[model samples]
Target: MGGRILVADSVATNRIALAAILKRGRYNVSMCSTASDALQMARAAPPDLVFSASELPDMPGTRLTERLKAQTGMRDVPVLLMSRDREAGDVVSALAAGAEDVMPQPFNELALMARTRSLMRARETDRALEQHQSTVRCLGFSEQAPDFAPAARIALVAESRARGIALAAQLKREISQPVATLDLTGALAEADSAAPPDVYVIDATLEAPGDGLRLLADLRSRPGTRHAAIVIITDADNSMAVANALDLGANDLLLVGFQPQELALRLKNQLARKRRADLLRASVEDSMRLAVIDPLTGLYNRRYAYAHIAQIDELARKTGRQYAVMLADIDRFKAINDTWGHAAGDAVLAEVAKRLRDNLRGIDMVARIGGEEFLMALPKTSDIDARMAAERLCALIARDPVRLPGSDQSTAVTISIGLAMSGAKGRLSLPVNTLIDKADRALYCAKAEGRNQVTVSRTAA
Candidate 1:
């Protein structure tokens, strides 16, 4: 509501009307008559939102939207379409063409204001999410145990040493960070170094004993820096070089002879892209965590457990190795909730999940399948190993009392475990449900024998 809005239309009257409306609503409005002019204006000073008529003097509003979105920084700006045609099909087409919203002409002022407010709110939400995701990713990167300095690092591998050094200096000045430059001379010698820069800017003209493309491919293939962003700078605007760069996962292609200012701008654009990609990756990981993780305990939930078991079962069939499944349930867990309240129950579950994680091998999968039940899949493990692991887990829980925060009482808890193992032939081809059922039966047997014990299915032996 407080920021600038760009209103573009070929028709003077339409532009004036929209500008007046936006101005009356306390928005700073910029008016333009052509798509090309709108693009220039938007790029120079991007508005909070854009309202463009479908028919522009130079190009269609759809094309304008596409062009603006294709640009480095303006991709996320919201564009609304205003057209006189007003047909449902036209509105659909405009939206499909990248307009965030479409309003038919002969518009109602109230509806227009409402839609504008909604779009603005949506944009603000998206921007906040993007920022949060970026922060989370940067935090995650920083928190890695090895403490890699990815944020402050840059690498420039170039053919022309003088040009590369000059560009590296400019880049360091522009970004206010140090950059490391390497040429064909240093590629093989320093390839195994512990620290690789976050970004690799390669000169496409580098001709060493091996192929230049192969060098790019090798840099990308390495585990330490596989995820680093790559940029290819070429002397000629060769389509082949550009295509090869793209094929080898180069993030951008830049012409070598650009002005210093232009070079800085291009470097800034690539850095922005790198930041956005980090944000996107964090968002995806967060979404995945929400989908499959139990919020209370930081363990995988039932759905993910099922999926993991199915995959492991298939792998067992192919590899012909023994695999084990274990189902664990806290004994008399409902009484804990009833006696101490749900908060205490949650604390108990959290403690149990932590113990399970701490006790198991890194490759083992453990998940919460229900309120007080958990499922663990141990691959390449026999029945004896599974029973030994379960016994240790059960003994630990029985001996350790969970101390709830802000409470004076400590509640002792115990777990019953049921384990099932596939035969030496490795693959049971049994349905996930059937495998779970076997473990569930074993769990029942454990409870029947006595709580705080481990029981293995007879079939498993």
Candidate 2:
């Protein structure tokens, strides 16, 4: 099946006709003759899209839209209203009342199907974001609502500069946000300091027939504009162009040129949806960072290090390359904390982490696995190279003194390191815990020999 659609029309012929068209497109259709019934049905099980005629037995389609918008679950569902005639006021009113788009009868079957598909695609995107957000919330991390106003940025790209300017001027009257006019060159140009537009109104037949369509694909490929809402303006009779436009990632479309009020409503709807998605994406990134990052030292935490080591061990077994695991402990960290206080000890840990990261190769893994103990992994390393790296880490820490936060005084710091390898090439790599244990024993030997030095495991050699 294509998707689920709820169709509401008082007229039996109208309901049958619309349902038949949708059924041919493979959409699962549910029919209702009154607005109240439609609302009740939707409450029981929400549909992907809602299609209703302007006049119902109990309420107008706009009233239905308002009611649907009020419901928390159905707020994101797209409502398409059908009007008896293409009256500008009715279209504007319907859209302003929160209908996704208002179709004037008798609507072209091809255009209706294209719009349905586009709306369904958008609805699915919203549902996915919402589901992910719910999952994040279940993990005990909730996203804060965005503080900034929803002042969406708009870009108008037309066939000519004059047309773009004219459209921009008209759109400015309908919406309060900033609007800019751009040519094809400007539209596809590389990003700069200026923020990318939140919604782009692009002409489908710019200089040539398919030029705008090509531009749509290019914009989607670009990282900066890929998530922006794209609305295509094409001829009402251009069925093929409309189909291709929706297929190429156009979020919405405007046929029969721009009607300022209708266009404004569509732009606003798209902006709201885009902003919600952006919020969800940001929340996911923040949650992931919190899960794997050490707050004090700004290094990967023990959990992340353990998981990474498993991957590295698997790779070494396949390639038959030796890898190194090292456990380093700050010398007399408890003494520092006892003498200077916890703040100074924290400062030392942060500085030591920085030094270790700076001295190691980019591919090396450095993580703070304990209060003063750090874990480091180096792939494809020999025992001699591992010992040299460990020595370098020890020297780097002892060479400098870290200043206490909010204090002028500085204290010298040093770390003792123990290194172990995953055996020579052509041998199976040791288990992650086994390598870690060997490194730990070597570290004990280092502490016994001297406070600040490097030691290698005998078995590893």
Candidate 3:
């Protein structure tokens, strides 16, 4: 099914007709006679979209939409209302009452289907984002509360400078953000700037044939502006141009002589959609950031360590040089937790992590593999250099005390390190786990001998 659609009309013929039209488009459709019945059917199983008659037998379609929107899960589903009678002020009232779109009588099938496809595309994108947000929340990560308003860029493009300026002036009265006019020749150059427009208003009736269409197609192909919202405005009755604009990825179509209020409302909707998309992109980036790093210690976690080690391993094999792997454990970490509380233990761990990171060369990587345990990797390194690096790490930690939160007192902590060297001569003779296991054993020996020291795996010798 392309999508699930519910049709609500009091007349049986209206219900059947709408359902047939949607069914032919391969939509999974359900029909209902009244607003009450529509609400019941929707609650039973939510649909992707709802089409309702403007006036129901018992209630208006606007009331039905309000009822559906009041439902917790159905708010995101679009509501489209149809009216055979184009009465004065009816469309505005229906729109104000929460209809996603109000289609008047004698609807052109082509235009109607185009609107349906556009709405479905937008809904599908939102659904995917909602599912991703749920998964991120399930992992116990919360989005940082945003404080700033969106400053979406709006660009007006036309072959005529005067016409572009006129459009910009009208947009300025409606949009709170910056609005700028660009010539057809300068559209791509402006798009390539540091801050590209979020929404584009292109005049389809440019003096040069297909000038606007070419720019629209190029914007869709460009990486920087591919996601932008494109609205096409035609000054004349060019049905072919309107259809072609829709086919060429125009988000909205407008008549050039339309009222500025109508254009403002449409622009507002486009900007809202753009802002939602931006937020979804940001959310995914943030989730990816959380996946690899430890929240408390601010260090790469175990998974990241293993993945990076594989990259380092490949480099070492190509270079035919020895690399070092070190496992470090803090001495008496549990005792520190028990005596000074977990706060002091956390402070000590964070401080030690900073010391380990700061003392290492840019070529080295350090990660927190377990509680009080850290793993370090150095690619294209020798055993002697590894030893000196480990010694320097130990001195950095033992030489200073960590400042505990909410207290003036400093807590003392020390770490032990176990290092193993890779095979020489451009050969990765041992697997990564083998090297880790060898270092683990040496770490055990260091802890047994006495904490706050370094030990080399016998296998390395």
User: Which has the greatest TM-score?
Assistant: 2
TM-score of each model, in listed order: 0.43, 0.62, 0.59
Model 2 clash pairs are none
How would you order the candidates by TM-score, starting with the best? 2, 3, 1
Q: How many residue pairs clash in each candidate?
A: 0, 0, 1
lDDT of 3 at 133: 50
- RMSD list, candidates in order: 19.7, 15.1, 17.7
Clashing residue pairs found in predicted model 3: 320-426
- Candidate 3 RMSD computed on C-alpha atoms after optimal superposition onto the true structure: 17.7
Give the poorly placed runs of model 1, Cα more than 4 Å off: 1-284
Residue 128 alpha-carbon offset, candidate 2, angstroms: 0.9
Candidate 2's TM-score: 0.62
CA lDDT, candidate 1, residue 4: 67
Compared with the true structure, what per-residue lDDT tens digits does model 1 show for residues 1-461? 35568998888988898888777777778998999889899878767789998888788888888898887657777788887665545554655566664566766665466556645644544454453343344344212223232464677787767867877887766676567778765764345578666667777767653255667788778876665666677643254565556656665555545444444454554555555555565563665476667999999888767766776776567546678999999999999999998999999999999999999975588899889999999877877788889899999999979997678889999999999887677346667688789999999999999889988888886
Please give, for residues 24-140, the per-residue lDDT of candidate 2 as tens digits.
988889999999999998887678899999989999999999998787689889999997786878887988898877787886887788788888878766654554455456556
Q: Go through the candidates in order and give each one's C-alpha lDDT.
A: 0.73, 0.84, 0.79
Per-residue CA lDDT of model 3 for 344-458, tens digit only, reads 8888888898888888875577889889999999876778889898888888889888888898888788889999988986457899999999999988998898878889999
lDDT of 2 at 65: 91
Using TM-score as the yardstick, the better of models 1 and 2 is 2
